[model samples]
Target: MLKRCGRRYIVGAIRTYAKDIRFGPEARGLLLKGVDIMANAVSATLGPRGRNVLIEQLMISPRITKDGITVANNVQLEDRRCNMGAQLLRQTTSNTNNEVGDGTTTATILAKGMASQGLEVIRQGQVNVHALREGMLEASRVVCEELQSMSQIVETIGEVEAVATIALNGDKRLSDMIGDAILKLGEGGVFLLKESKCLNDELKVQEGVTLPEGFVSPLFANQGNGNRVEYSNVLLLATLANIERLDEILPALELAKSKEQPLLIIANDISADVVKALVMNQLRNCLRVCAVKAPSHGSEQRDQMQDLALAMGANLLENATGLSAIEAEDLGVVSEVIVDSSSTHLLHPRIHNEDQVHARVQHIRALMEEAITDEEVDKLNERMGRLFGYLATIYVGGANELEVSEKKDRLNDALHAVHGAISDGIVPGGGTAYLRCIPALESLAPSETPEHQIGRDIVRNSLRLPCYTIARNAGVNPDEVIRQVLEGSGNFGYDAAAGQFCDLKERGIVDPTGALRSAMSEAAGIASLLATTEVLITEERIRPKVPRNQVTKDLAGLIGM
Candidate 1:
């Protein structure tokens, strides 16, 4: 029987074939080559002295950036096998960026060093590759512990500036702006970056709560005013119920219309018919109303809705039954609400339970302290921001669009780095923290197996690559710099930008401990995976046809041309 498959046909086709495959050293070598290329490109943007990379865009002007993840993301190899290897390294940087926000370059450089060394050890046939990979991971864990132990809390704005400065590659003005925002907001504050219309950077702050949710339909927005909706003295119905039927909240809509007030419904969902009914009432001027899908999902949705309802002085409706029984006393009120396609903002309004809101904020802060994963911590921070905190935005300005884009990227990096420093504390910068942990890694399992020992050695040596690269980029001898750093104690390291040796903190050079640790752990993880890779499989590359004349002699004669 013939069957349709995608855009092609199949006649009892069940078999599959490998397009390309390589085994042993050949596969590993090509992958390593790709890793080398990507790492080399990114490492050039590693430290205070790091150089900017110019990236060509599809239609717009090229981008000039010193961001490591940006450079790593733009690299593509011509060799398929090599590209596969580069992709693996790219994942390492991507993971670091997502988790820590500012360690992609450090992660890439470390992964490259470890993978290259592990491959060399494998080629010698002296140790078990699996055992070596295990040792590398174990060493990585120990180094992470050491880094945590060495971290210093960022108590003052100066410390915050230091972390931001390193992330921004010594842009002190931008770093100071981030520091000021953090200072003004205190802990758990939320601020964002935006492009400025003016050529001078600016900062704006307001009393409001922001949610990553908006109107259910554009029809709900003010007509012909883009996808934006605004209401004054609004009534809010917060619920987890999925509103498929209009009658579920018709009583509340009537109450809103009678009171001559705009109504906003925040719920898990709103079906098409329900949205249509709401939009019709709004269009006919019978009622000013809008429905918004609740922020987040699952338990998070429940928690956020509850918090939002509390802040808006309303009680949360849990199900369709609760929605159907909605009363004036059950709904909440806010001074004003402004919503767009992407987000909703509740301006300074009413607080039904001020003490409870304070209690919830404390609870979230406590949860943040115990949150094990970055995802958990981030969610908790968002909750804190929505519950009760300052909201600020930094408007980045530049001479041109490309310049603004580049500065925005740098500001984003600085912002993340500062937040990381606040949460996880700061460490000696310029890779000093990684090097300081080498002693702990070396001392681990003094009587381990040969393969394990080799694995540990590979990771131990790879940890120094970040500092080495930083010095090399600064036009200094990296080996000498590493030697001097090892000879000194605690937070003592090279200042690549100044080409001097001193305590990193004294030089106002420090890294967010969390980002630095993420860099180490993620790099080691990817390197171990590459170390044990004995087989590589990838799709065959298809080349485009070469251009040629379309008309042959026979065709031309037939056409009488």
Candidate 2:
């Protein structure tokens, strides 16, 4: 009987070992599923026309916008399995965005494709664990090569337009306008260009623009003690000196009244008598006032002051003797006085012809407006919907040019937008560009080789965690979700190929937390793979050996029982 029992025990142990080994396949499948899901999600937003799907799901309170980073950052996933994958994906996306100003979607797609293809080789029982690693390295090399081949040098404004059009998916008008704006701005000046129909209007120049010495109220009327006032159609003129006081108000008021124009008082300070006289004249309602402090003598201070003046109101003036003097000279009735310390001499306001720069600016503004339109934006969405594509630019310039820095910054911002779009859209990359490379990794997969198989199993198991999480959050059966994702028959929430989401429907309707979940899963997978073999072995061996006996153990010890 004892012999029989020993045989049974041995059989049971063998069965348990078999069960453990079987788990390897399941784990591997899960990892592949996660890689596919995330890859597809990122690839959905590759081109310039890529659409941001998550923005649509946002509540009415938080305005929705089709931006990938926002969507990816916002996704929420219920399952812990996908957390690492999602996190790694997001990190990769973010890194790509920060580095190139574009191509985040492509990078994400590449990563997922690489991981999936690597796993396939292991599954095929061809390659060993090292072979899979080698394959991934080669895959990365290919992706980089492809990216380099696609990247074009943008040397002229025309080249910029071409690139923009490509990124924007052939929006000619939109591309033209953006190009025009860059060309019009050139390198040296700031121009206030109006935006029309999403396009920028012609640059409006403020001649002899002056800056205040220090920050002060936007409403100050001519060195006066007058009460605070408001007005419509008030012209603002900025100056550097403190001149006319209460004595200047009446004369200035008389001249202003003669023109039957509403009055605005602007100065550093005013005399009390002037304030009373202006009130008695019933000119208070006709007036709006702003007082700006003078700026220090320096280019930086001047620039800061000029920006402030522009923010207040248009029509900036330099130096003026006093309100009384301005009135006597009939100097435009002091529509609005702005004080600044940077001006060397007084300036007379002059009218600008919008027609001069109007065509150029207006054209650009129109393009931007058109690009953002429903139809145009949709086209962009379509182009971006493709998998495993990249729009990249390498900006090469001398390190010292401020213009280069500025251009680089703008480019980076645009690139960041592309990344954000991809994260939100959640599409796959290039139909698994690493497909051809799988055979190399298959040679690394082991059949009876336990150690090799263990590595493959670890990677496979890690990938599945994301799939489980995605399934749970989407409220789908985890097993069914896993199978469908792996088979490429269904999507988690958004369509990678369409760059649209049935769940979101509108722009800015994605769950950023879901993206985070995917990223976290990827991270965990990496951590597991990189951890020391000894650590993994310890984790596998450690087991619960004791049962609850808290009360009895303490009591028995106290009684020396």
Best by TM-score: 1
Per-residue lDDT tens digits for candidate 2, residues 115-160, read: 5544555566644556444333333333333323322223455544
Candidate 2, residue 197: Cα displacement in angstroms equals 10
Give the Å shift of residue 220 in candidate 2.
6.5
What lDDT tens digits, residue by residue, belong to model 1 across residues 126-189?
5688888888898999988999999999888898888888888888888888777777878666
The lDDT per prediction is: 0.84, 0.39
Would you estimate the TM-scores of all the predictions? 0.74, 0.38
Name the TM-score of candidate 1. 0.74
Clashing pairs in 1: none
